[model samples]
Target: MITADKFLIPARELGFNFFTGTPCSYLKPFINYVIDTDGFDFVDSVNEGDAIAIAAGATVGGKRAVVMFQNSGLGNAVNPITSLTYTFNIPVMIITTLRGEPGGPADEPQHELMGQITTAMLETMRLKWAFFPQTEEEVAPALKAADEYMKKHNQPFVFVMRKDDIAEYKLQKKPAASKKDFSITHTDHFELDYKARTTRTPVLEVLQKSVALSAAVIATTGKTGREFYEVGDQKNQLYMVGSMGCALAFGLGLAMVKPKLKVIVLDGDGALLMRTGSMATAGAYKPKNLVHILIDNEAHDSTGGQGTVTGGVSFGTIAAGFGYDKIYSTDRLEKFSEIVEEVKKNDVVTFVHMKTQKGSPEKLGRPKVTPAEVSVRFAEFVQSK
Candidate 1:
């Protein structure tokens, strides 16, 4: 079996230090090595798809990232891999463990089908992949090949890892910091219809104005992103095009890496509800520069304005419960603007849940800049200082 250092030393030498993934038994040793190593940053993702999106964001932030998971969880990863990474031409190193090898191991019945189809599924997804490194001689070449392919295509390259490929690597310390004594509060009370509250336009306008040039803004998918673009696209703004519900995770990744740059996420109620677990993930990491803003329009404004059941939800209470250092929930535009301005200067991990109306401008336009261009521009701005 190859020792963990066999692959990790070379991978790190090639500037692949940012790591995020869901845990799997087959990947335990490698994950332990990554966590214990001094130069690596690993995020325990809530799911495989979120892991991919986080890695994509790290890539855009000028870091080479690796996302590792069990092959079975590849099903969870397919959406962002196709829609987010593929569509945007973002490159991330992918490492998926072989849970059910077709002929080698008679393991659980659940893993059998996944084992057989894992490589085939990757092929169908049009992602170029190679087997995980199993020898000292193979390490540099494997990473080299992945680096070349990713640099050329600007897409993900997979390393299908098999069981017993990596030898045991013991962790010397806890993977996380000492748990902070924090609590979450749940409060939900809204009494307003779409016609009574402020529309998304002004809410976005205030947000666009609140962001300083040193800060980075990430807008969630759907009308929220389109509306933010319509309001005003800036070098500091990144509009997520296809990775639905990934804005918060992306912001978290950016804030964690670029600690000096304030990273704010402009999230929609529908989109936030889609991946609420990401909030818990962000709270767990507790990046001081991260700010999460959720505008509750109570509808899928991008796709025909279907109503969502957010009026009954207490997002601030949820954020506080999720260990956010500060929470703000408001229905008034004045209160919303105040909170936005406050977070721009504050260093605490904060969440602002603002209740807003459903409608946007009559002629909402998509960002003229393409997703790839947005990623590059945002990356450049983040690293500028």
Candidate 2:
């Protein structure tokens, strides 16, 4: 078999230096190697989908990122893979371990069905994939093919790795000490007038004018993005369409890779609830450039205005528990504008939970710019010095 460095060194030479993924036994060596290596950055994501989103963010920030996870968790990654990467035409390399090889090994009962259909699943997702390189001689050609395809199509390429592809390598780096001391500041200015509170349009207007042109804004799916697009579209703004809960994670990834760029995530209550684990990830990494702004209308405005469970949920406290450096809660548009302006001046992982009325502007329309076009321009804006 080949050493982990055999493939990784070449991958690094080709600009694949940023890595993020969940653990798989088959991928342990690769992950360990990356963790121990001096030039690589590895983020252990909470789930497979978050891993893909994080890697996509890094890719958008002009870094060649690689995501690795077990095939069992590939199901978890399907949402972002299809909606985020495929729709946006953002290319990131994915290495998924084949845990349940049908005829090759007598495996656990859980892996049987997934092992049989792993390759088929990849094909169904319209993801071009190949069996991972098995020999030293195969590594170069395999990476070349994947790299060429990704560069040409601007879509993700997968490598389904079987067990024993790489020689075992133990991780040498020490785990980071747990963060025991941290503070969260909550500024509550809610008047508790749900109907009288400001709607999304005015909030979007304030954000449009408040956010600096140098900062990158990522709006979560649904009315938030639509309203923001309606307010005004800019080169620095990315209107997320289908990846409902990934805005924060994507912003975190971009913030990590592009430390100089301020990454703002305009999140919705429903979408934020869908992947609250991302907050914990953000808390752990604590990217100083991330600004998470949650407009909690307490209803899913895009989906027929269904009421969500966030009415009683205190997201500022949640952000505090999740380790955000700064937290602000408010219902007034003026206070929110102040918070935005305040956070823009400082480099801190900040969260603003704004309570707004649950409604949309009349006949709100979607963005005319396609997701692919937005991604291209957003990436260019991110890469600009």
Candidate 3:
């Protein structure tokens, strides 16, 4: 029920100046205000945990901090909070904008469960947090209470607010950046007219070459997974079932745990377009053994074959902006081999872009396993590391 300016002023007064996290419409007014202001340092972190880590580092260096994020990102923040902050006695204030509140008209089905579990998750971590303050007047006191709680406990505390309570602000859209192609050379062995073929053969050839050297691969949903599955052994690959555009997170966890083995992720244009922030997360935590191979088909081929933003959208540039040091693109096979060889020895996170065919094979069905089973397999894989 509080105005964005009101809470922001008190947050400033409390010495909480540094802000980090993903954008939320409900939190935009507060976020944009800090961004436009001269004094406040606002960083749009790749995920919630990155925000937490940034805030934690700032706190350690003698600055008060705030991390504002969507409740859906709580899953991503839990590890850092419990392992790094809680164990290390780091205190940071978290302000999360709640999405699907109970009794609010049903929101996107994808967010329903995440919404319901938000508070329970905080409790499970034994961290202190409170839902929407009862009135606009309560915002300042709630923040103060959380600050006091953090000081006393040396643990993170969260303030969750509903959509209706916060104000929205307009965001300035930047001009589109120049496009960069990730295709190197075509490894296609066939002699057909290369320009007319509908298959993603060139990209598949590159992925096959990568998998031949790597121990594990994770593919995001849509055409990338389909094509990667088409070219490589599914037994060594984790077919992402439901979580669209989350292959990097999977690869990050796997790579972090198993630094000795190579972890590859086959990402898609549509899938990456949906959640591009994962690239920043990929960059923040440098893992030498991790390789993200993006299969850019340039369309949402799995869902009615709609055109994607990436046709005009350049993921290669985006990866570069997110701090991927080794970025290469080519439409030819020699270039592909050059980039692949360069990426193989790098001791840092890498992103490879490969343009592919527009559509996947027809009659694709969901995996026979349930979400729980998929999670179990992923858990087992991570544990094996």
TM-score head-to-head 1 vs 3, winner: 1
* lDDT per residue as tens, model 2, 219-281: 999889999999988999999998889999899899999999899999999999999999999
Poorest 10 consecutive residues of model 2 by lDDT? 181-190
Candidate 3 ranges with C-alpha deviation above 4 Å: 1-198, 230-233, 333-338, 362-382
Model 1, span 1-385: residue lDDT tens: 7998788878889999999999998899989999888999889999999899888878888889999999889998998898889978889999999887977766788999999999999999999999998888888888899999999999999999888999877777764466577554566545566578898889888877766575789988888889888887788988888778888988887788888888889899888888899999888889999999998888998889899998678888888778898888877887788888788888889998888988878878888999888877888898785
How does model 1 fare in lDDT? 0.87
lDDT of 3 by residue, 243-350 (tens): 565566556655654677677777777777766777877776667878888766566777876777765565667777676766665545556667777777787778
Candidate 1: stretches off by over 4 Å: 175-194
- Please list the Cα RMSD from the true structure of every candidate, rounded to 1 decimal place: 1.8, 1.4, 11.3
lDDT winner between candidates 1 and 3: 1
* Cand. 3 TM to true fold: 0.51
lDDT, candidates in the order shown? 0.87, 0.92, 0.68
Pairs clashing within candidate 2:
none
Candidate 2 regions off by >4 Å? 179-189
Better of 2 and 3 by TM-score: 2
